[model samples]
Target: MTILVVILALLVGLVGGVLGGQSRGRASRAVLDDSLQREAQAQAERVRSEAEAQGRELRAEALRVREEASRLYQEAEVRQGQAAQQREQAMADAARERADAERERADALRERGETVRERETLKQDRQDTKRERDELKREIERLNRRAEQLDARGEKLDAVEEKLEAHEKRLSEEGTALQERVRSAELKLYEVAALTPEQAKEQILSKLDSELEDEKAIRVRAMQERASADAKRHARHVIAQAIQRSASETSAALSVSVVPIPSDAMKGRIIGREGRNIRAFESLTGVDLIIDDTPEAVILSSFNPVRREVAKHVLEALVQDGRIHPSRIEEMVHKAQDDMKGFIHTQGEEAASSSGVLGVKPGLVQLLGRMYFRSSYGQNVLKHSVQVAHLTGIMAAELGLDVSLARRAGLMHDVGKSIDREIEGTHVDIGVSLGKRFGEPLEVIDAIAHHHDPENGETLYSVLVAAADAISAARPGARREELESYIKRLENLEHIAVSFPGVQSAYAVQAGREVRVLVQPDKVSDAQATLLAREIASRVEQDMEYPGQVQVTVVRESRAVEIAK
Candidate 1:
């Protein structure tokens, strides 16, 4: 039984061992499977990662290729545009060539026609000369024939004269005897009437004086009427022509320059910390920057326009760059100053060129450029000078003077205004001094000196400049004055005319440009009226400070009335 039980135990133990082995095998297999699954998952993740990276690379390559294609397309478009522009330019060139050819042909034709006309005129003139020569010969022949006939008639007349002389002698004797009888009769009548020769001569002289006085009065009245009519017709025609020939536009200028800001916040930036930025800017640029209640605006003020301009540009740069500091401000100010010099020179060159004034000294041109920022009575001095130049040139052309010289004088006329603030004398004096220093011509210097108040004898060029200056200043909207000043000028003009002895009344007309004086006909003769007008004009010129010229017109009338009773 023990053997059998041991056998059973061995069998059971063997079975249990077998069961354990199987379980061990199963656990090892399960472990192997789990390890294989994990390896497979790791391999799959490696493949997925490789695939994702490849996909990303491919996408990147595709994007690069697309960008390259787009770049090529843009380049092509640019090339196409360039080609089109080139083609258009070529077409324009062709058109211009054609136009030039046509113009040349037309000019040739005109020249040919002119030559033909000249030949024809020459032939006609020769023919006229020949005809005149023949007519003169014929006239000489006729005069000779008349002289011969007169000689024959003189021979015939000599015989007839002998007989007529004998008859005339008898007639003379009879007349003398008749005159003696008449004289004797007159003497007897004078004795009987108790009259002497002296009294008769005195009466005759008085009658003659009365008749001569009447005739003199008639002639003087007729002469005055005719002269006045002619003077009016001629004066109107000349003045109208001068005015129509010159026309220009006027622009107003101000002393202050304005810079625009993007917003109110920029004001604080411009002010900077403790106002150091602004203070530095002003000190460097010599301009006052006024940041006030004015929204989005900054005002730059300085008597020196160049400094003001520099400050304006510097401020604009600081505001735009969003950097406001002392160092940056200084840098900008220096840059602005450099740029301003170039700009000012360019402006001067342009002004000189546009005014048709050539050969100007560079220094004078620079001085003239300063007028660009100057204002006189709200009128830009530069613009006014340009306008004067144009007007002067026009008038000079009409009057057959030197247009270039006139234009030069007009352009430089106001150059002194630019430096007047720095100089110690009047603009005229400074201008004259500058002109002399710069070796300007005598005429230009004279014009600069005497444009405002011409002395007793001013050059024609000076007069032209004065006239042009007046025309430019006196045009509508060209210049403006304070209301009080304008009114005072007008009142003064009228008062001057009224102060004359024979002036019954005076009126200031045409915005103080003209004064009309009415004189009593009895008190002022026609000649006296003319003198009075001149005297009034002279007085106004001496006493008043006015723009443009004043016209003095004196009126005198005579009336004759008859009563039909």
Candidate 2:
């Protein structure tokens, strides 16, 4: 509300100021108009006065005009005189100007005439220049035509010369060849083989055949060679296929079980615990009863697989008889031990008879029977030996090796394993020493020593033994229970062998018994491959601990061929 009042007051003040200014201007304008009117009146009055004064002057001028007319007449007379003099002078000057103009026109006409002549001369020069240009054009055209004709002739000559040169070169080559043939004919004629034309021809044919000198004949020979190679290849393929088809012996799992009993009561108690019962049982059977199960059941463990089996039966018998006592246990145990021995002997005889392993001593047979108690890498050594023997026989027969030697080597390879726990050195060394001392063949001894050392190259039989052992051990799931450290050692054996330069790939085959390394052909030379194989084998020996030995094989191959069409 206060602002509104202030605005109203300002508007009122502005309106009043505008009205006062407009009124003052109007009053000033009215006063100015009155003053202008007075000034205009004064101007009019002054103008009237001036007009009167001008009228008076006009009257005076009229009088003066009369006088002036007289004076002008006189002056006109004098001016006429002076004008006459000036006209005369002007006429003279005009005459001179006309003369000068005429002179300039004459000079200009003279110069134009000279210029016209010069222009004609220049036109003549232009015509000459045009004629010279035409003549030069004709000359150039003629010269160009002549040059073309010369070029054509030169080209023809050059072609002829090139033909002659080519012909001469061909003749020279033919002549040289003819001269060489002549020299050769002269030389051949001077040779010891004096010959007529027919004889020479025949001798040449004979020489071609003898020396394999003719390319066509060589081609025929190559064909024959290829055919022969193909036949050999086919034979090899057939043999390989047949071998694949043939039945092969596989590694056998050999495990032993030792059963324990509860008490001596069970033992003869196996015999029925009485003198009468003991006598009856001893008379009935031959078996040993161990009444002591110190901490456990009756010890029913033995090396002889058969004896152990029989002992099992005898114990079963005594248990069935239900006799109980220390004496009876003794009786039953004795009978059981005896019966078990007989069973073992029979089994040995049977094994020998079946496998054609004759001349085996009974004591040795018993010792062999004890193998039932022994195990190597979860395998019963005796059974493994038997499997190895069979595999060796089959392989030897197929490969045309010594079948009997291979089988014997395989069977005895692990013989030292039986006492290895009790003896020092590797089983191979021990078995070799044992075989040598026992008067076995040198071959057998060597085979035993190098069975695990194929690179030893001591004997072929050793290689066969090693191969058989591998075949037995490499079958699926065979030796699966090997110690983790042993398996890792075998893996490391192959890893070390393959770690060498140039090997592209490596496989630990034959239950880690062999490392087959494939080397880059471009990188590995044949000599280098051989050295690498030897080095890998050495590295396996020095860096790895493994059962048996590892065979390192490095293979490198290169091929070259040319294709013609």
Candidate 3:
């Protein structure tokens, strides 16, 4: 730009000089014009060189800009490639996730297949059981036929015995007639011989008396034999008929009930907030909640069957609801208690219907239902009652007594057991009271009061009930005391474990097969805990008797907790 300006100024100067020379000397004018032309040409050459350098500089700047743009384009392409790689990586990640999902699905399907196979195995086992039952039925039928043959033979023997009794009676009659004729002849001889009348009279009287005693003795002996035969035959028939009319299956009850959980992790949830939930549940339900290392299971233990049942329901509900808190525990406990009433009613009704003892008052039925939870010597009281009812009914029908009255008496024989723990009396006393309160017949009440003592039975029906009760109670598997001993042993184990030094708590689980003890970490070291377990186990072995073996576990734990606010 500067060079162009300078060249334009030189043109203007040359034009001015030419105008002035025209008015001056020619030689001066020529010199000035030459000088001016040379200056103009130099200025033009300098302008051209400067412009070319400027052009070169502009071209260099453009080239630099183009190079910068090329670098930017390269960077953009690299970034695009990086983005594509990232996309590929993400796709790979997605594929891996999909693969993991497929694997999980496959595992689930495999587990389902195994479950199906197990289900089929269970079905097959049931079929095998059915087959065994069928075989038992056939055997029973064969025994029945054999019994019929024995009965026929017994009848024949009975007929023969009757005939012999009649023959003996006729023989006694002929002997009596012979003795009378002898007495008459003796009297005549006494008169013909002219013996003293007083002496003959005394001799004849003594002889006749002796002869009469002998005849009476013979008749009494024959009568006793016939009576014995008759009594034995009748008892056998009555017992056989009663037993044949009844069938039952039952097992002893246990003190603890196990509730299944979704997972072991739920143990922590159930023992919430420093075990407030568990403590609340135990207090509300009157049950001991034994949460141990037993996988996916917890035990609710109480000597009271109803309380244990309620605790079981509460725990199951809490687990299914997945909300375990003290308040929720109390709520569930109340709900379970309410449910228990319905359950008890249903059980009572079923017992009545099954035992064929109708017209039981609702209140009486409720009491009967309570007996469902009550057990005597490890026998379920309600079930025992039903079996007794069946036996009594059958026997009463055969013995020409009131069948319904007998059944009712038998079914209610143990009704007092329902409240035996509540009221202050023996079951017999409570039962008699309840029977009267419910308007039971005199025979029924008498049976309930004295089923344990048949000698006190007031009527034939009461006697039959007592007999039936004896039969039902005597049946194999109907009663057991092992349950009580089993629970006692477990309690004894816990007691022993808790007696140890530094032990905080002890729980007997695995049906008294194991005892878990928690010890204070500050008082008991890890080594001490091990020794404590051994000591507890030794104590249990020494002080208690249990089936199988009892495992003792002592846990000493130290926990650190902090609150972040």
Whole-model lDDT values for every prediction: 0.83, 0.68, 0.85
- The local distance difference test score of model 1 is 0.83
Q: Model 1, which residues run further than 4 Å from truth? A: 1-219, 225-240, 456-458, 482-565
Per-residue lDDT over 471-550 for candidate 1, one digit per residue giving the tens place of the 0 to 100 score = 77766556665556777788888888888898899999877778989999999999999889888977986799765467
What's each prediction's TM-score? 0.48, 0.35, 0.46
Instruction: For residues 1-565, write the lDDT of model 3, one tens digit per residue.
Output: 5665666687677767766765687765666767777876786677678877887887899999999999999999999999999999999999999999999999999999999999999999999999999999999999999999999999999999999999999999999999999989888987898887788788889999999899889889868976975786577678756765666876578999999999999999999888898889988999999999899999988899999999999999999999899989988888899999999999999999998888889999899899888877767889889999989888888888888888888898888889989879998999899888989888888888778887877777767877777667655446664445656677788888888779999999866768899999999998888788878877886788543456888888899999999
Model 1 is weakest, by summed lDDT over 10 consecutive residues, at: 235-244
For candidate 3, the 10 contiguous residues with the lowest summed lDDT are 474-483
**Residue 375 lDDT, candidate 2, scale 0-100:** 62
Best candidate (score: TM-score)? 1
User: Considering TM-score, where higher is better, how would the candidates rank from best to worst?
Assistant: 1, 3, 2
Q: What lDDT score is found at residue 172 in candidate 1?
A: 100
